[model samples]
Target: MSLAPRIVLVHRTTEYEELVARHGTHGQAAFFLASRGRDIEEVAERSRRTRRALDEIAAGIPLTWRQARVERADLDRFLFAPEDVVVVVGQDGLVANVAKYLAGQPVVGIDTDPGRNPGVLVRHRAADAGALIASAVSRAGAVDELTMVEAVADDTQRLLALNEIYLGAAGHQTVRYRLGRDDDRGAVEPQASSGVLVGTGTGASGWLRSVWQERGGGLVLPGATEERLVWFVREAWPSPVTGTSLVAGHLSVGARLQLTVESDRLIAFGDGMEGDAVELVWGQTVRVGVAGVRLRLVG
Candidate 1:
């Protein structure tokens, strides 16, 4: 008996039918994926509808579908082998990291959002809505919405954010923060501020920098000698003490002063992540690093 062509499916989506019709598994095609909650039923219904749509495009193409649990070992097998084709049905984050894993293979990304794919490699570009969809399609993968179609390769290969991320002062209290890498030998007092910020190249235009009387900013640009991150903060506040005599127009005897970040916590946060509140001690350190991979999108 001859074996049918096999195509590994990653992240369930509606685009599989066109893939199956064009390249039938001949009964050997199987799907491997992590549990997607209870959406499998919906996918099965969509598959039936997709089969009907494919009939008009290509007649008499037989397709048999089955899904199996995915294990860590199975992940290794799928990534290394050269299958007929591999379809990724994950969110933007999933797609971006997947590319790194299957660096040399042909992995077709499928997502409802278009911005995940880096379309034409425009110089010094930031990911936008239009750029996302076009990126995926331009890469040889196809694009469609709410229906199955041949997957394209126009992966713009950029970051995809499901929820928006922002930086701003909490409450009315102006915060004191700092920006700057560790000095020689990772020592030395870091730069201090009433406000500081570190954001992605894309986040430069956003709220990385809060309101600063001295310098209105919140950014660490490219060509920065060490790491590429922005930071912001407030510096100091001296508390005035008014004695009974002072209230009566007499001189005061004592006063107190407090640092900004000490009184108020400097926090960093955005969508899908819990906020981190940091109180920096003069000699201590707080570090931020870039994630290993950018986000991905498929339309």
Candidate 2:
């Protein structure tokens, strides 16, 4: 028998959560914030709005639909079925956060604080959930196929990210590796720097753009739907055995930038989630490129 599509609601803990976590109670949190010359009401108000939106969204789901809620911290442990309609109930970053774990699920982004948060990813209001849910089930929704980046370690471990994948030291310290392509010049030069970042077009709008701006805007960043990849090496120092020639560049679809570990330890992580990462030891090679899977996000 066939299975019905499940509705997966994704959210992240708010600032109010951390406030109460440290202060024990909302009243105590308020007092602590007030003592620091800050108003806790603002934080509480935002948290209230987020919770209200989540409730409204949940209420709109059909009773027959199998639904589940997964927090941002629990995404790593949660398993998503193929027939799942993901509804991200938070800011823009939450959508990007859930994108890595998903294969091709349709993500509906709901924004709690429209004025405070950028609605680039979470572009819809809670009231639109009913129609959006119907559209997604019928495959009639406006879905954007966003490109993603992937890194594969020599040991067969892999990582995916909607924004970017970073390979470097755990502390963001100087990374030692050989940067090059697979053709004639397999591994070009040994580099020691902050690390390397392999990003997609979606990433270009954020961190990649900042790095491009810092480098005088030479790299050609692709669009959100483009099947392209761009790379950048941070603070690559010059030495007798090292070179900075492969500082920044772009990769066409299916092409990969190879990096062999020269340091005792290096970590590969996606979308800034350093805690859940792939570890690479000396002499290990990691190839980063555009992933075949794309994020099917409802616009």
lDDT of each: 0.31, 0.90
Off by over 4 Å in 1: 1-180, 190-195, 209-227, 234-267, 271-285, 297-299
> Can you write out model 2's per-residue Cα lDDT over 1-299, one digit (the tens) per residue?
77766999999889999899998999999999999999999999999999999899888888977889999999999999988999999888888899988988899989889987768788899999879978988899789999999999889999999999988999999978999976526558888999998898888878888888999998789998999889999999999988898899888887889999999999999887889999999999999998989999898
The TM-scores, one per candidate, come to 0.30, 0.97
Displacement of residue 250 (Cα, Å) in model 2 is 0.5
Report residue 12 deviation for candidate 2 (angstroms).
1.1
lDDT (Cα, 0-100) at 143 in candidate 1: 32
For all candidates, the clash counts are: 46, 0
Can you write out model 1's per-residue Cα lDDT over 79-113, one digit (the tens) per residue? 34433233443344333223323433344444332
Clashes of 1: 46
